[model samples]
Target: MKIIAKNKVAYYDYEILETFEAGISLMGWEVKSIRANKVNLKNSFAYFKDLELYWSNAHISLYMAVKGDEQRTRKLLMHKSELKKIHFKKTTNRLTLIPLSLYWKQGKIKLELALAKGKTKYDKRQSEKAKEEKRKIEKMLKNYS
Candidate 1:
């Protein structure tokens, strides 16, 4: 799969519990924009409305040759069973659904959705410390080699 865009901050701010692949409903212009890598997954989230899933805040810039809304809420297409499962987990665990990445699959655009819990400040700090330690270890090994 060729990944087009990702929400880099999502991993830093949330602990992912589960992941799901979803089909995004996009207009022709929006799809073109995505092919040009004019998409941003930041601040984008999925929500359930009337038992259906919709993504909000994901920005797909208008194509240079086409005119359309850049911030429209897009519907996510998934099986009914999957939707119910996500809803159950979300309500019971108080988790959130975040858009992790957008990618191409079988010539169609698909979204990677993650069920996650927000991290606390201490958790963030610990993650940062662990990352720094890993970097130091890699650097030490490089020098030894």
Candidate 2:
């Protein structure tokens, strides 16, 4: 898959439990802008509205001569069963849905979304420390070989 945009902050701030693929409804201009790599997934998330899913805070830079909101809410296409499943988790498990990445698959734009739980400040610090230790270990192993 060719990735157009990624939300790295989502990974750092949440503990992912499950992931799923989703299709996005987009305008022609928005598609063109995305092809040019003028998309941002930062702070973007998916929410439910009357049993349907909508994407918010994602930005697609306007194509020249196209006037519209760059961060307008967009609809996400998914199966009813999957939607119901996600909603169940959301309501009972208190998990949130977050966009992990935007990419192209089979010539169509696809969204990789994760069901996650928010991490505490301590969790963030522990992850950072673990990463640093892993990096140091990898470096030492490389030098030893």
Candidate 3:
């Protein structure tokens, strides 16, 4: 799989519980723009409406010649059974669906979405502390060896 773009802030702000892959509905020009490396997934999220899924806030830069909204909502294609299960999990657990990454899978563009819970400020600080401790341990081990 060739990775296109990743949502860096999502990892920092949310704790991921699960991940799902879904195809994206895109126009020809939008696909071309993505291929040209003009896509951004940093602030994108997915939502359920009419029992179907839609993604918004993901920016696919306009193809030079076309005039349209860069962050317009786009449909996400997934199996009906999976959609129902995801919707149930999201509602019951009070989780959110965030797009983690975009990549090419067997010639089709697919989105990797995470079912995540927003982290509190303290949680972020604790995680940062843990990372720092791990880094220190690794450095000490390297120096001793």
Candidate 4:
């Protein structure tokens, strides 16, 4: 799988509970833009409407030679069971679905959806501290060896 773009901030700001892969609906120019490596998943999220999934806020730059919608709401295709489960989690568990990455799988574009809960301020601080501690440990080990 060739990853096109990744939402690095999602990892820092959310606690991921699960992940699912879903196919994306794209237009001709949108797909072309992606092939040119012009897509962003940093602030994109998925939502359910009419029992169908739609993704918004993901930016796919307009193709230079083709006039197309730059940031259209793209549909996400998933199995009925998966969609139902995600809807349930969103409603009952209060979890959010964020698009973590966009990649090509066997010539088709696929999105990796992360089932995540937003991190509190303290949780962010704790994660930062843990990362710092790990860095320090690695440095100490390197110097001692």
Candidate 3 segments exceeding 4 Å error:
none
lDDT of each: 0.96, 0.95, 0.96, 0.93
Alpha-carbon runs more than 4 Å astray in model 2: none
lDDT tens readout by residue for model 2, 7-122: 89998999999999999999999999999999999888999999999999998999999999999999999999999999998989988999999999999999999999999999
**Model 2 residue 55 lDDT score:** 96
How many pairs collide in each candidate, listed in order?
Answer: 0, 0, 0, 0
State the lDDT of candidate 1 residue by residue for 1-145, as single tens digits: 9999999999999999999999998898998889999999999999999989999999999887677778999999999999999999999999999999999999999999999999999999999999999999999999999
Q: Which candidate has the top score in TM-score?
A: 3
What would the per-residue lDDT of candidate 3 be over residues 43-84, giving only the tens digit for each residue? Answer: 789999999999999999999889999999999999999999
In candidate 2 the C-alpha lDDT for residue 85 amounts to: 91
Residue 9 lDDT (model 1): 99
**2 or 4: which has the higher TM-score?**
2
- Pairwise TM-score winner, candidates 1 and 2: 2
Query: Which of the two candidates, 1 or 2, achieves a greater lDDT against the reference?
Result: 1
Q: Lowest summed lDDT over 10 consecutive residues: which window, candidate 4?
A: 63-72
Q: After superposing candidate 1, which stretches have Cα over 4 Å from the reference?
A: none
Candidate 2 local distance difference test against the native:
0.95
- Return the candidate ranking by lDDT, descending: 3, 1, 2, 4
